[model samples]
Every structure is written in C-alpha cells, then in structure tokens.
Target chain A: MPISPPFRMEAMNNQSSEIIYTYAGPRTASDTGPFVKTRLMIREFIDARELIIRLFIRNFSSKYRQSVLGIVWAFIIPIITVGMFMVMGNAGVINVQGLKAPYAVYAIIGTTFFNLFTAGLTACTGSIVQAGSMIVKINFPRIALVFSSSLMGIVDTAVRLILIAAAFIVYRTAPHPVGVLIGFLSLIPLFILTLGLGLFFSLVAAILRDLINIIPFATMGLMLLTPVLYPIDNSSALGVVTQYNPLHYLINFPRDMVLYGSSELTTGYIVSAIISCIVLIAGWQFFYMAQTKIAERV
Target chain B: MADSVITVDGVSKKFSKSVRHMMLYGTLDLTAGSFGIPLARNRLRRGEFWALRDINFEIKRGEAVGLIGANGAGKSTMLKLLNGIYMPDLGKISIRGRIGALIEVGAGFHPMLSGRENIYINGSILGMKTAEITRQLDSIIDFAGIEEFIDSPVRHYSSGMYVRLGFAIIAHCRPEILLIDEVLAVGDARFRRKCLDHLKQLKENGVTFVIVSHNMQTIDGIATKGIFFDHGSLRYCGTPGEAISHYEMKMLGNDAPFPETLIEGSTKPGSLRLVKYFKDYGTHDIRFEDVRITNAQGEPSESFASFDAATLKVTVASPSETKTRMYCSFINEDMTVCMGAYMDISLKTGIQTIKIKFDPIQLTTGRYMVSLRLYDEYLTNPYANGHFGYFSVMKGGCVETPGTNTPYCWRTPEVTIA
Candidate 1:
C-alpha cells in the first residue's frame, strides 16, 4: 500500500495558508449590535481595573528606576515647585491679591491640582501611541491604555497632595476639616472630565502623531489662562475666563471648599461641572466612533 | 453544526494616502498664502485604496491555518483585524471565542519590570484573570526556563530570554483562538522546537490557531490550511502544499532559471560547477571512484542505505599556478546548504593536484549537492565555485524491499539481489 501522506502536517500547513488570505479586505463598518449586551461593559470594566493597576505600577517604577533618588524624587520635585512658588509670591516677586487664604497655601493647592490635571491629560494623550504595538496586536479594550496612564498621573497627584498637607502641618497652619472632604469629593468630577478628555486626546494623538508636540503648548496656554497663580473674582476678565474654563472649576471648587470652608458650589462651578460631564460624554462618543479607524490610521 | 468558529465576509480595508501626506502639508499650509482651496481640492481628489480587497473565509474550531505572502501582502493587516485592533473598512467578521495573540512578543512588557511582574502585566493584557495567572505562573516560569532570573528586571534579560518569557506567558493564557505572527523566527533552534511542540499540544486540545510565517519549512510543518496573498489580495486559499509550491515558485523565479533542455548544463558554470568538495578529516587527494559507500556494517556498496552509517572519499587537485585556498559545501536537493569546510594549501610549481577524502558521511538518505570553491588565503575573495556533482544515499539495503516500484527507488533497482 502507498504510504499515507502526513495528514496532520498537511492539515497544519493548509490552515496557515488560509489565514494569510483571510485577513485581506477593505474597511467596512463594524457591527455594533453585539455591544448592546450589558455584560460586555461589565467584563470590560473588570479588565480595565486590572490594566489600570498594572499600568500604575509600571509608570511609577519606570519613572523612578534609574534616577539617583528613586521614589523620593516624586516628592521632591513637587515640593520644590511649591516652595519656589511660595518664596516667589511671598517676597513680592509674584503677587497674590484678592485671595481669602495665605498666598503660599493658596498657590500650593492650585499647583497641586493643576499639575494633576495636566499630567493626566498629557500622559493619556501619548498612552495609545506609546503602546502602539500592544494596541495593534492584541484584542483588549483600547480605553484601558488611556485610563491606566491617567491613573498613573492620579497616583502621582495623590502623593503630591499628601506632601502638601504635611508641609502645611510643619508650617503650623491649622487644617480646615472641609479641605479633606473637598479633596475626596473633587476626584469624582476630575476623573470624569479627565477620562473623557484623555480618551479623546489619545485617539487624536494616535492618528496625528504631531499633536504630541502641540499638547505641551496647549497645556501651558491653558495654565496661563486659568487662575492657577492668582485667584479670580467676578469683577475681572480673568474671572470671566475662569468661569468658562472647565478645568478652573475642577481646581478652584476644591480649593474654595477646602481653604475657605465654602459649602455651596458657585453657579459658575455648577455650570462648568455640567459642561465637563457633557464634554466627557462627547469625548467618549467621539472616541467610540473613531476607534475603529485607529489601527489603520496609526 | 457550523464548524466555523470565525467567519469573515466580503471584508475590505482602505486607507487614504493623501490624508497621511496632508499631515506634512498642514505645516506647509501655515506658511502658504492660500491654504483653504488647495487643501480642499486635495482632500476631494484624495480617495481611498483597499489594503485588503473582497475576501471571505471560515475557520473551523481547532483548525491551524497559515498565512503566507511577500512583504506588504496585507498579512499583518489581516491579523490586526482578527485581533479586533482594526475594524474592517468594508467587511463583517464574526468571532466566537476569545483571541490570544503573540503578534509581537513582549509588545506591552515594561523593560524596567521584573520578568515575574511582566508575566502578570502581560497576562492581563492577554485577557487572563489574576487568579488564572497565579495558577499558571509556575508553568510559565518553567516553560520560559528563566526561573533563576524571574525576579531580575526584564531589561537585563537577553532577547531570547525575553521572547521565551513573553511566549511562555501567552501559551499559558489558554486562549480559545490563538493568533501568532512570525514570532518563532526570532528564537533559536532549541527554543523554536520547544514552541512548535507546545503549539502542537495546543492544537491537539482543539484550540484554533492563525499563524503567519515566511519560513516555508515551518509552514509545511505546522499549518493545516494555507492562504496565499499577493498585492493586498488573496491570490489563492486552499491546501498548504499548493500554497507552499506557489510561494516557492515565486522565490525560485529570481534565483533559478528553467533548464532550456533537460540535459543542457548551466551557461555560466561558476554558478553551477563544483570545483572542490570534502567532508570530515584525514584522507587527502582522493578520487571519485575510490570513494566508497557503505552501511553501518562497513560493507562497501554502490548505493547506501537510509539512516545508516556511511562514508565518502573525494580528491582535490591543486594545480601549481592556481591559488591553494579552497572551501567545500554540501547541500540538499532543495538547494539548502547543509554543512561546509574550508582549508588553504599553498603548493609550489610541478605539483599536479591534491587528493582529499571524507569518510563516514553522517547523512540521511537523500540527494545532495557536493560543491567546491577556490579562494585567496584570506578566503574573502572567490576564484572559482559551483556544484561539482550530485549523489544519492539510498533508503535501505539491497536484500530488503527488493525491486520496489516506489517513485524514488527506481534509480537503484540494479543493485537489488534476487
């Protein structure tokens, strides 16, 4: 009898050939019908949480790994920036007028909050691109990459906030009880806003890599436009600009509640917070719509 | 019952080249006097071209399929679509199970993290739960063969070690559908064999697999079905043998010319001629007729047996005026060089030639290319080189399976005893 050909080997080789031809095709709209199933989001969220923790650890370790001071450097830089702002403001080189709290305390709080917002935003914008190979090779929620990078920034922000509070204690400034409450409460809106903006910008950055260059300039312009250095009241153009700036509410609402014991949220704060929610939803919608194109575009 | 676990229908993916080019133009548009109208016209004229044209396929559960193509044949783009990294621009794809891919091993691994840490991180990326990773962690470590260095930063691991760890984690991920892309080619021989064996085990367990490889031997060895892609389209989709033949045909066109006449020799003998050939050591200035073939028993024969001990003796002539440095190479029928040897012998005038002999050729039964080359003392420059001749080592002794009509056995029937 003729020896039978190696059936298993033949089968394997044939299967591989089929796969080569299988992936070739043009872009068609994906069927989003399956997405209506509620269980998908729950699974995605659980997966995202794991990814977030992993990313947070990686970001933390990688940032500090080769540095001389390691993790201590995280606390040192923020302290220096806060101290520089304090010294400059107190010596009359930088003026802080029309504020209810001491200038150094107010500046520290503003810098801490703003730093968190900008760092999260900037890091999230590059996350998708930096993780380009992963995004393109594996099947996972692309949103995880953006959210995880933002989470890393949040961890840094939390560390800096703790250091600021310790400095306040050392300086003999009596802690306001409301400040603690505001700190926890503010994270909700801040997270919602950052997640939305982060996802949107990450998508944009992946498609148009040059946006990476534009992001820093935009954030700097935004910092100058907001009242991070000086407090804004109703009488000034700066106040009007701050009222319109969504990030201003994220920063000032917590500051006001913490330092000044303001229980009532300002009308501008309420309006901007609503806008922030809308912006976030809109960003998510935009990302959801554009995500299908990301693999091709990137 | 639908055996197809993954179905792709009329899929086409298109990308706009002008859109990518216009990114550069935007900076230029900043300086140009008129940016609006030209940019608008360019955008309008800039249309889309499909990277993947109309294609359709159904992959059954447990099937191991191979994707074969030249560069830019849309093989990678297809893997991306299957992984859900890209939605097809025009087609619909339905997948039934979770996909675990090793498209680029260590794609998401952080260099600063320890190998143990990266396993957790990579496992999560592959959609494995923490509990699952914990349970399989030991297996991953064992498979990777880096237990001693698991805690060291992955940045310190060699590239082979990194790939092993990455692949080990992926293998233990227990994906229902697996997509692999050319990752095996990066590892060494032993590691490659380990991965192939692991993949075979996985296939036996009914896991569906999609693989892309440029190595034809690998495709022949592992794939159950095959697809041939050309210029962003599926040129053929069927059996692996045919696909491999197609690929080989494409490759051979550039290197091997079809013989005009069956007996006609190569026009430029330098490409085909064999000047000097030798194997092993000791014997020198030997002739072809004196070269004896024998079984493991050391009995001399014209045709040697398969999987048996054998020896070959060859003689090299070092003409007085010619350079004495020479190199010999042995190649299989498929034109792959199996092994080689090099030596230099500077001879004075009046010497006719040198005889070289090789004994106990440790080779399996097959046709082989015995080629030779003469070069300078440095061995960098070549003077003359090509295949000297071809020889066959038979599959068995003459007394057994006598006068068999098997396709390859016809040439040696004369040696069989009644």
Candidate 2:
C-alpha cells in the first residue's frame, strides 16, 4: 500500500521507547482552516454512520417498547391534529374554496411532511442534552446524536405517510402518480433543513435548556406560519405571509407532489433549497465549534 | 502494539464555574479564535479556572499508564482530554486507533432500552460496527452473565447487573487503547475477580491503557507507569511503585526515605493490604512525649470513620528550643501510609503540646497508626514521637463510598453518571 503509517510516526526511533506526544492551544486557526474542519465533519459523519444506525435502532425500539400505544403515537397525534382542523372546516368555521383536494388527504399529507421538519428539529435540538451522560464520558463524534434522532424523524414521517395512504383509501381516491414521486423526493430538502437547524439549536439547547421547553411550543406556532392546514393564495394577509414563507414552498411542494401531480416548481422552491443548504452549512460549523466545550457544558 | 497510538502536547484546558458566563465567553472565544484574533485565553475570566495546565505526555503501543491525584487535581479532566471529550484550550492531543474508554460505565446506555439493545448502542459508541457487535453478541451476554434478562429493559436491572453489563460490553470491544476511570469493581467478589482478570487478559494482548483509580493494588498490578498529578500539573512520572510512593510522600509533605526495615518485603502487590510495622530505631534529638486523637465533635475517640474529620494532639520534649521537623504517619491496618506528612516547628525547651486536626480522614476503613515522628532540622535523626494506638477506621457511611477502593473524598465532585 502507498500509505504506510503517517510521516511523523515513521521518524520515531522504535516502538518500545517512549513516544512523546504534544498538544497546543486553540488548534482551528492553524488550519486552512474551516475547509479542513468541514471535511473532517463529513468524514466523521460517514465513518460513524454505523454508530448512527445503532443509536437510531436503540432510540426507535425503546421509544415504543411495552407501551400500549406503541408506534400508534406516531400516527395518532397527527391524526388528531388533522381531525381537529377538519372538524373546524366542516362546521363552516373555515373556507376551502381555493383548494381542490379533500381536507383529510390535504391535511394529513401537509402535517406528515411538516412533521418531518418539526419532529426532526425538536429531537435533534434535544438530542445533545439528552445524551449528556455519553457526551461527557465517551469520546465519539457528537453528530451521531443528531443523525440518529433525525433518522427517527424519517421513520416517524414514513409511518405518518401510511396514515395519508389510509386516508386516500378511506376517501376512495388515488394520489396523482407524478405528485407521489415528487412528494417523496421533497422529503430530502426538508430533512436537510431540519438537520441543519437541529445542529445549531441543539448546541444552544445544551447550554440554555430553556430552548428545550420553547421548541415544541414554538413549532406549533410555526405550523400556522407554513401552509400545512391552509392553502397559499393571493387573498388574506396570512396568505401574503405564507407567500413569503419558504416553508410554504418546501412543505407545500411535497404535499402537492403527492395529493395532485401539478406541484409548480416556483421561484420560491429554488430559494428554499438554497436556504436549506445554507442552514446545513451554518449548523455544521456551529456544532463543530461548540463541541470542544460540550463535555464541560453538559 | 505496532504504532505510537497516542500523542499529547503542551495541552491546557480551563473550565468556568458559571454556565451563563461560559456560554457568553465561549462564543467570544470561538469567534475570536476563528479569525486569528487571539482572545487572551491564558488569563482566567470571571468564574473560570484552569482545569489542566500546560501538560504534556505520551504513550506507546501496549503501555498501561495509571493516573493518580488528589480530588480536583484534574486527573479526570486529563482523561477527558485524551478521549477528545474536552479539547484542550492550549495544546493538541491526537489519539490513533479506536479508543474505548470505560471512563464511566454504561456511559450511553438508554435505561428504557433492553439489556440486549443497550449492548449494541454501547458497543457502537465505543466505535464498533453493527456486524462486529452482532458477532460478539452471545459472548457479551455470556460475559455479563445476563442471558436470561437480555430482553428486559435496563431500567429494571439491578445496579450490579447494570454495571456488569456495561463492563462486559467494554471488555469485549477489544479496543487497542483503553482509558478507564476508577471502575475497579462493579459487583461482588466474583464479578470483581472477573473484571480484573478481563483487564489482565486485555493487558496481555498488547492493549494500551490509561487508568485513573485510587486503588493502588490495581495500579501496582496492571499499570507499568504512573502519572502523578497535583492541581492540573504533571508532578511525577515513574514506575507504578515509585509513583505511588512519590504521590504518598508529596501528600504527607515529607519524602524521608523510609528506613530499610520498614518497606523491604512490604511491596507485595494484591488485594491484601500489606500493613507495615516500623521498629523504634532512632537516637532521640527530639522526642514525642504524648499524643491524642479527637473527632470533629470534640469527642475523644479511638476510631474514626473514613470521612470523619479528626484531630491529632502531639507533645514534644526537646533539650533546647531548637528548629525541628515533625512527621505524622497515617497508616491503615491493611496498607502502610504511602508517605508521611512532616511539619516544621521550633520546639520549646522542655515540653510543648501541639494539637493537629484532620478534617475528614482520607483513609479506608481499617486500624490505623497516626504515628508521630520527630526529626532534627535536616531530618537526620528520627524518633517514634508517639503513635495513636490501634484505632479503627469504621466503614464510612456516605453515598460516596464505592466500597471496593479507598472510598472517595476527591474525584467525587466530578462524578459523571451514565
């Protein structure tokens, strides 16, 4: 092999003798330097993917073990939330003239995709503090915690999608074939956005635990800000706000991808994709920097 | 065994007591650090203290190094630094190979998960792949002796079962570099023997180890080298025996080489505490005429608990009011005092009784000799001074008692539970 142990190690006299090791202060600036840090972060993620899967299995299995509800909690909560919105819509408290899809199909699809972002972000934000014992004691890439929880989000979102399919069966209608393809594809950018936001917020959550209490409450409000339960059109101020909201494009694109085949690739969709990439980069940077001190902080 | 597996250089790490200030200043440090704007990190900000200071050391393949220190002496911090749990503020540390640290047993075990599941998670956290862990699954269960309860949620497992399972997974990982913090024994005698044997077997297979435990027997047996730290600095490094002696001598503040009769055959390594008896052999330049022991409540007691604070009162008689040094040797019935603490004093011509108090006696439960010895100014001539009669150190009743090693008064502040 061309790679025979590194340069400095070979220069050493022999194995039996004491090999002196050295450490220096604040090492990141010595690098090119952020480039190396980014590369290492990606390398760590790939190298630790097995560990991530292990943690994911541990979390996913333990989450539903022995409880009566079991995996039903994944579907039940979204079912209830969508059920509440449909109840209001049926009572004439809300209007649906601008929408073409059934409220059951529309609401379930929107909430399922949005749940990927909301649940993934919440779990990711809380994962660091939740694994404080391991973070302080074991030496491994801390990103595994975020990755595992985000994977759980994927699993949960998949289960919630089944609820959407079950709704389609109940309604006796089929999803637009092209829409289903794009709808599944849309999950990718949503996950990237969730992971990015999760990495940054998780660090802050480890420090100021008030973020833990604030996240679930905040995500509930964020659902309104996105076009999850409502259709985005040019009418109300809420619609205007939704017009500017990138999540409206991100979440709606996927939901419309499955509910109907004609999910317009708006200029906003391109912007949302760009934003997701930005969040991922920023989150990875912040998480890596904060990691050096997390053992002490947690 | 083929490579230099670990390197640490000029490393220093500081910790802040206040979380709020740490978050604020940490942000400042991170930003200032990224742009090459060196924030004066050397200076301790408010509520910040140096946990590890400009320390440097290294380990080659298959060498076992033991870390010894008083509480808050940064032994655990150094271990954390080596493990990459906490990066040093000043220096860099590079550890090659898959590092498996039993720094705290069950470090990542989810209590809600079953014993079987936790094994996978813990093994993976130690850097094992799923296929590797699966191959070892039966062995892990067999080592832990938890086959029947493998499917039971770990929350339902007894504490002994919990630690056993944790250690079993760690031992099976076969890490090339192992860093263990004070996990000498987790269960009864059978389990203790099993754990020690596993460590011995691992050591024989050419694994490098950095162990931090106050258990001298473990150090004397398993560790080839010992790193003695005091307040975050590398104070002494030598053979395990010499390191223990040096550490003990430093703690007592006197390093008078013991008379040959004292420690000749006393260095036997094992669980058996080799209690030593010193023959009275010095011509009297100064003499210890009387001595007394009292507990913290001022009760004159013959025995003290391991955690009890007590006092030693000594009266010295001398020919002249001359410059002299006084040494008190605190000995346990099982193990000899690794070293004695000697105090410098000017004696009164005839007799002056001095009262010295020990707040929270740092000894495991056993009979002890708070032996008083006197010396000439330069510590040449020595006398028995006086000895506290066979007062027992009763079992310390505290949550800090681990019951296997000298139960903690130090390192207790830094307990990171899994």
Q: Write the per-residue lDDT of candidate 2 for residues B1-418, one digit (tens) a residue.
A: 3466777778888988887887777667655644557566577888898888888777887789999987799999999887777777776676665567888888788888889888888888888778878888888888888899999889999989988898988887766678999875567678878887777777776778999987666776678999999888998887876777656555433332322233322222211122233456677656555555667876667656667777666656778877767777776544478325667777778877676655566665345666666777797776445444545565332433232454454421111111
For model 2, the superposed segments whose C-alpha errors exceed 4 Å read: A1-35, A90-92, B1-5, B30-37, B250-418
- The residue-by-residue lDDT of candidate 1 on A108-140, one tens digit each, is 777778878888888989988898777777767
Residue range with the least summed lDDT across 10 consecutive positions in model 1 chain A:
A18-27
The fraction of reference interface contacts (C-alpha pairs within 8 A across chains A and B) present in each candidate is 0.35, 0.47
Tens-digit per-residue lDDT, A17-101, candidate 2: 2312222212322344447766767777897899988888888877887588988888889889888988888888767556787
lDDT of 1 by residue, B224-299 (tens): 8999887778887888768866665554443443222223243432222332333333233322222223444545
Q: What lDDT is reached at residue B177 by model 2? A: 77
Each prediction's TM-score versus the true structure: 0.74, 0.74
What is the iRMS for every candidate structure? 10.5, 8.2
Worst 10 residues of 2 chain B by lDDT: B409-418
